[model samples]
Target: MPRLLTRVKSKMSIFAHRKARGMLDGEYGSVFKGRSLDFEDLRAYIPGDEVRDIDWKASARHGSPLIKRYVAVRRQTVLLITDTGRNMAASSLGGEEKKDVAVMALGVVGYLAQRHGDVVGMVCGDGTASRSWPAKAGEAHLERLLRDVNDGTALTSPRSSIVEQLSYVARNYGQRMLLFVVADEVVPDAGMERLLRRLRAQHEILWLTVRDAQLAGPGVPGSANSGPEDRYDVADTRFLPGRLAASEAVIRAYAAAQEQRDGGREAALRRLGIAHVHAGSSHDVVPAVFTLMERHRRGK
Candidate 1:
C-alpha cells in the first residue's frame, strides 16, 4: 500500500506541475481552480477582457481601458465517490484490476487537491455497504483516506448497487463540493440519473468510468472476437447469463451493445453538465484525468 501511495504521488507530481502552469496561463478550468481572488494589479484592457473587471475611473485617468488583475486565492474541497462493487474487482483491458486503477485514479485527484491546499475526502462502497471519510488537508490525512478506501473495498461484498451509494452521498453530504464519481462501466438507469441530477445541482460533478476488459468489445485481446473458442462472463449476479461463446454474431452484438451503453452513459452525463473521463486501463488513468482537467480549464 505504501509503495502504491508513493507511486501515485510521484505520478501526480507531474500532473500538479502541469496544472500549475495551466492555471497561470488561464488554460485550465475546473472547480479545483481557486475561485477566491486577491487584487494583484491593474493592466491595460485586452479586447476579450471581462467588462465587469474594467476599472472605469482608472481607465478615465489613463485615457485608456484598464482591467483589474487578481491572483487566485487557493482553497477547495474535493470528494472522491468510488464504487467498490464486485464489478470493479474485475480485470480491465490494460491487464490490471479495476479496483487498483480506481485507487490510482483516486490518488491522482486527491494528491492534486492536497497540493493545491484543498481538503480531500471520500465515499467508497460496494453496493451493500458504504464508508465515508470527512474532508481533510495534509499528506497524512490523504494517506489515511487512501488506506481506508483500500481496506473498505477489500472487506465489502460485491453485489452492491452504486446507485445506493450515490444516494447516500446526495443525502448526507450537503455542502457544495467538487465530486468525482469513479466506477465501473454500469450505465445509470432512470432512478440513478435522477439522483445524479439532484446531486449535480449542489456540486460540481466529474465521472470517471474504468473500462473492463469484458466490455471493451470485439477487437480487444480477450474480447469475444479474439477467437471462436473464447468465452466471456458477465460480471453481475443477475439472471443475465454469465458465460457466452465467441460466435461471430454474439461478438458483433456484444460490441454494438457495449458501444451503445457507453455512448448513452457519456451522453447522459454530458446533458447533466458533468465532466467525464474514460480510463481503459491502469496506465490510462492519470492521462485521462489530466485531459479532463485540461478540457474543463479550457471551458470545453
Candidate 2:
C-alpha cells in the first residue's frame, strides 16, 4: 500500500476502534440498522410456498417442503457530484482552503450515506468526469470512493461546464436516485438550467454551494470598516487600499447578485417539481445533508 493509504488506514482504524467502543457512536450514530436484506434463512416449506425460494435439497432430505426466507432490501443508492474547477480555488473564507472544504463536505455526506445503509457513488467533476463508480454499499466501497474523492487529480482540469457531465450521468442511470451536488454558487444561468433539468427529470437533486463567509455577508459590523484590506485584483494580484472598503462593497454586491441568481434557480427547479436547499457555515454540513435527505425521503 502507498504511504498515504497506510496513513489513511491507520487513522480509520483509530476511528473504527473508537466507534466500536461506543465513544463515537452518538456522534456518528449507528451505521447499521438491524439486519441487512442481503442475508437469507432456510426453513421447511409447506403448501403455498414460494416456488422461487424453494430449498430442494432440504425438501428431499426431510421428505417435506422447504423454503428460503430473505431479508428486506435495506439500502438506497446515492450519487454525489463535486465541481473542482479554477473557481473552486477562490478562497475568501479563512477555513481550510476552498478545495479542501469541498472535499471534506463531500466526505461527510458520503460517509453518512454509507452509514444509513445507502450505496454511495461519486462523480468528481472538473470540466470532464475525473472518476465515477456505480453506487455500492459497505466499508470497502466507501473507502474506494474516499480515495477517489481525495485524489489530487480529481480537482485539476481546464474550465469545464457541469451541464454536460450532469446530463451524461442522469441519462445513463436507468433507475431513479438521490443526487448531491457541491459547487460554487456562481454559474451561468444556461448551464444551471440544463443541469437542473436533467436531474429533475430522473432523480432527486440537492445543490450545495461552498463559499467564504465574507462572500456570504459583507455588511457585518467590522466588515464595513475593514474595507481596504479585502481589495485584491486577481488579474494583477495587486492590492488597492481604501478601495478595500469598496472591494468589500463589491463583494457584498456580488454576493447579492449570486443570491438573486440562486433564488431564480430555486424557482425554476420548483417549477420542475424538484426541491432545493442552500447551505452555508450557519448550518455546517451534517445538518444540511440530513435536511436534504429528509426532503428526498418526503418527496418519495
Candidate 3:
C-alpha cells in the first residue's frame, strides 16, 4: 500500500552506515558493481572480515590475518526472479509472510543494482503462468517490481513453481545477466536441476530461499498458541489438526525433512556452480544477500 522501495533503501542505508564495521569494510558497494574486479591490496583483518576474502597463504606469511581488497569493474543487468503464489503468502520461519521477505530481498538487490548504475528487471509467476518486465534503471521501476511480488502473491493464488519461471528465462532471454532468485523452500526435482544447469551456462545465478514456518513445534510463532483453530493450508485454506502436528515425533520428523530439503537445495546450487543463501525474514535479507554476492564473486 505504501512506497515499498523506500523501505528497501532504508535497509540499504543501514548497511551503508555500517560499512566501516561491515564485513567488506564498505567494499559492499562492489558487491553489485558488475562481476569482476581487479586485485588491489590487503588490509589487516578485523573482527567481522569475511573468511572467503582471507588470503590464507598471504596471511600465513604476514604472520597475521589480512583481507584482500579489490576494485570493482564493469556493470551488470540484474534480473529479479520470484514466484508469486499461495505458498509465498504463507508464513516464513521468521513468523512473517514469505511474500513480504521475498519482496524485501528483491528490493534490496534491485536497489543495489540501481545504485551501481545497472538496470533491473523481473520474472515472476506460479505453476500456471509466468510474467516479466523489461530491464530498466529507476526507483519507479524497482517499486513496480516489488509491488508485483507483493500484490500477486496471495493465499488464493496459484501454486508455486520457480522451475517454470527459470525455464521461461532460459527460453526468452539470451543476454547474460545476474539472475537474483527469491522463493520459498521448494522440493528439488530433476527438471528443476536441468533448468538450473541450462540457465547457469547462459547467465550467472544467485538463489535466496525463504525459510518456511515450522509446522509442528512449540517455540514457533504459530505453534503453541495457534492450536488447531488457527492453522490452515495455504493452498486451499483447509483446517489442519494442530494436535497431530504438535506431536513430538511429528515435530522431529518435520524438522529432519526440512533440514534435508534445505541441504538438497544448497547442494544442487553448489553442484551447478551457482551461489545460494537462505533468509527467514526481512532482517536477514541484506546480510544473506551480501553472503550470496560474495560467493558469486568468488566463483567468478
Give the CA lDDT, 0 to 100, for residue 27 in model 2: 31
Please, what are the lDDT tens digits per residue for candidate 1 over residues 162-256?
Answer: 78678889879987788888888878788888999999888877778888775322334544445433323336443322334445566688788
lDDT of 2 by residue, 1-300 (tens): 543333433444455553445333233232222223355778877788658678788889878877878775667667877765554554534433455556555666666666567788877656645557888876677667655645543223455445655766765776666677776554447666766776676666666666543432332233435333444432234544544445656657767886787787666666665544655532244455445545544552
Question: Which candidate number maximizes lDDT?
Answer: 3
**Span of ten consecutive residues with least summed lDDT in model 1:** 237-246
Alpha-carbon TM-score of each model against the true structure: 0.78, 0.61, 0.81
- Residue pairs with backbone overlap in model 1: 28-297, 29-297, 127-160, 127-161, 128-160
lDDT of 1: 0.73
lDDT per prediction?
0.73, 0.57, 0.82
Model 2 CA deviation exceeding 4 Å by range:
1-73, 92-94, 128-130, 153-156, 187-191, 212-227, 230-252, 281-283, 298-300
Candidate 3's TM-score: 0.81
Whole-model alpha-carbon lDDT for candidate 3: 0.82
Ranking by lDDT: 3, 1, 2
How many clashes in each candidate? 5, 7, 0
| Tens-digit per-residue lDDT, 175-227, candidate 3 | 87889899888866888888888888878778899988776665456445555
